[model samples]
Target: MTVLVVTNDFPPRQGGIENFVRSLCDELPEVVVYTSREPRDAAYDATLPFPVVRDRTSMLLPTARITKRAVQLLQEHGADRVLFGAAAPLGLMGPALRRAGARRIVGLTHGHETWWAGVPGTRQALRKIAEAADTLTTVSSWCEDQIRPALSPAAAQRVRRLTPGVNTRRFAPNCGGEQVRKGLGLEGVPVVACVSRLIRRKGQDTLIKAWPLVQESVPDAKLLLVGGGPDRQYLEELAVRTGVSQDVVFTGPVPWAEIPPYVDAAEVFAVPCRTRRFGLEPEALGIATLEASAAGKPVVVGDSGGAPDTVRHGETGYLVDPYNPVAVGVRIADLLSNPQHCKELGAAGRQWVTEEWSWTRSGAVLRELLDV
Candidate 1:
């Protein structure tokens, strides 16, 4: 059961989908990948076990050359399953893959397909692809709900939920964050860490706004803002205006290999993501929250997107208003104050992730989906 994968999101980029696609490929034996990035240029290419075909086109979208080559690969390998790593890519090469003897045509619908569907042209094309594909899977319930209306009744029936998974062995309760703390100069302090790209939708500003209130409750507590984005300068300015500059530490864009230590550095992990529709940028199956939980840390997230699926409200972590700095502050303060409760919640999260959300489990589901 050879499988051919078409995807724009691949290594040399850092993201949830990129990691998920790679993990899925790692699970299957007969899989080949095609990507927009060239193999010679990417640093992570050598790390992958499967073969990959690189496109030479300058166009952002899939080109005719890619389509022809994909069909060639499918027919040549006798590949029965052709999995489009994303919904958008299917619009380009789906017809060719079907004609080339692909028994299973599958597309993965992440959160942003909902944003693309808002456009009249893209919406119709997405629907056509949905109707054509054998199945379409979503990483989050929010994404599944967002895409359902755009799909035909028959295509909608094929929709399935497959949330992103965490590598529990790599990210666990006993993993030490001494390096993360030493690098960020947050030694011997109660840290509230937020690990995500510092963007408007991720609600880093809301967390910064809530820092002063958090300070009054736990004065020595530090807000460790990890990851890089356009919001860095603005967030720094806001911290200055709010006069919590010394307390907020920014480690811009840590590498994927180093993410676990950052998670381990925190007593509480927070991702106060807000609902953004213009780009449809919801949390959509938060791998970070799961990673934090795996590392035995209590999580604090907003009510939007797939966050609720990861954090079990009061059981694992608190769900607060992403826009409300006061609420964010209060939750952090509560977690910081109660060491025993924090340990309890963190243990609960670790146990849950260990039992339920592992790459091994996700791989089994993906194999079942491809019927391989």
Candidate 2:
């Protein structure tokens, strides 16, 4: 089976969707990738195993010109299937791609589609593309719920679950994590690390608010904030204002390969992503949460969207309300205070991820659903 993946999001770009596309392409067979022309991607493209087609389009999504080029690539490569990375690129030319005579036209939806579906006219746009698609895949059951209702009963049947997974090979437990602790100048005190884009929706502010209470329990503890974004200055100031500035450490965007150690550095990993705290879409799925699970670290996620999916609540980790910092603080303290319980939860999580969510398993599921 020959499969062609078309998307604006790829390796050089950073996001959940970009990472998803890269992971899927790595597992799927006889796949050719199509991405927008970015000068930086020129070097990155060479590292990929599949043949990549770079379209010379100025915009991120080649909506206006994708039709002609897609048909041409389909014929040249003898491919009978096309997979769109996300809904926007698929919506732009979905109808045209449908009439182009491909055996299957698949649309993949992430959590953001729910936010877009809530907008005035986007529901109909999503309905159109999904109806035209032969099969539609969602990153999580939460996202599947978002897109399924928009289409007709028959069209909705096309919606299938192809959940996100972690690369256990790169993010497994026991890969030498001593480097992370030494770099932070921390010696054997409990640490809670949150790794993500420092956006309001991620609930960094809420964590900051709860730090004082956390300190009251474990005064020697440290909170490490990894990854950089626009909210850094505000969060830094808020940390100072909250009187926990000295206890908090913000390491601006660490290298991708170096992330596992950061996960290993802490006993508990927190990502309090929410729906209403910052009035944004809740996290679709916490890939970092899964990464933490792989690294044998218990996670703390918000009770919103797919955040709960990552942590099994009382098993792998705790699911606290992102708006309630007290809950977050308490969970962090519980994990840190009892080292044996923390280790048990982390071990259970590591075993769960290894057995259930792997790229090879998810790819095979997608392959079967698409009949490719």
Candidate 3:
């Protein structure tokens, strides 16, 4: 049975969820993708192996029209199995698709559904989606804990864990970092890199706030802020305000394929993510941090939600209180100051990731869940 992948989060729009969904697609036996429109999507889709159906709308809501389109795709592709990339609202269309002859429906939840599990109205909506889907996949155990309780006992039992995988070969040590450093004129500088959307919850501001302390310990250290988001202006202004503007390099919106070189360009990687919205929005599982670890760089991740699940503190990396800039700075500085310690931690991370977190392992679990 061909799997029909449905989601709003897909390339050529760049983000964690987009990359997660796209990577999972390669694992499926036969698949057809139905996602919202993106600029340069035609060029992107043309490069893909399977068919990609773009919606007129840029974002899809589970309205009657959206449901109709999804059902039509299922029938056209003869896809008995349907996979909703980020679950929640998209998974709401499962019932409609089932009525149209879909056998199995899997809804993958990142961190957002954990929040959906809390609020009253959205919690009901989440439960409904959970009931509709044959299996609900959570990216982390913490995420599974947050979302499962909100479902009915039967639906809760169907919840499973299927985290994203890292391509170890693609993100390895010396994978074009020297060239990236040369291009940026950052050759031989001790760099702390954060690769994610420059959003408040992802904590670029906290990284900036912590920069002065990092600089005190390693005065020649530079901050490499990658990816673009709404918070770009705010983060830039905050960097200037913190007096780390000259040392901070913003590589706005790097291509997905080019991310590895940038990841390799850092001495240490950090993302001080925090829970916001009264503990609603949290970092689900930081793919970037895992990528950095895969690149043989020690990571400093935030102690937010599922983020801590990504790092083995002091062994692979350090987990700091996201709200505490001093704590974040200290960890980054410690790694920067001690080259041997950093190398040891990074080597441990690389070994751990190679043994555990590979696309083959993730794909096998997903295949079992989909049973396709």
Candidate with best lDDT: 3
Considering TM-score, where higher is better, how would the candidates rank from best to worst? Answer: 3, 1, 2
For candidate 1, the 10 contiguous residues with the lowest summed lDDT are: 56-65
Q: Which whole-number lDDT from 0 to 100 does residue 44 have in model 3?
A: 94
- TM-score for each candidate, following the candidate numbering: 0.95, 0.94, 0.98
Sorted by lDDT (best first), the order is: 3, 1, 2
Clashes of 3: 0
Better of 2 and 3 by lDDT: 3
lDDT of each: 0.84, 0.81, 0.93
Better of 2 and 3 by TM-score: 3
lDDT of model 1 at position 115 = 70
Clashing pairs in 3: none
- 260-355 per-residue lDDT for model 1 (tens digits): 888999999998998886546777777899899999999999888777888888888989999888999999998999989999999999999988
Q: On a 0 to 100 scale, what is the lDDT of residue 57 in model 3?
A: 96
What stretches of model 1 exceed 4 Å from their correct place? 38-40, 57-60, 277-279
lDDT of 3: 0.93
Candidate 3 lDDT score at position 295: 98
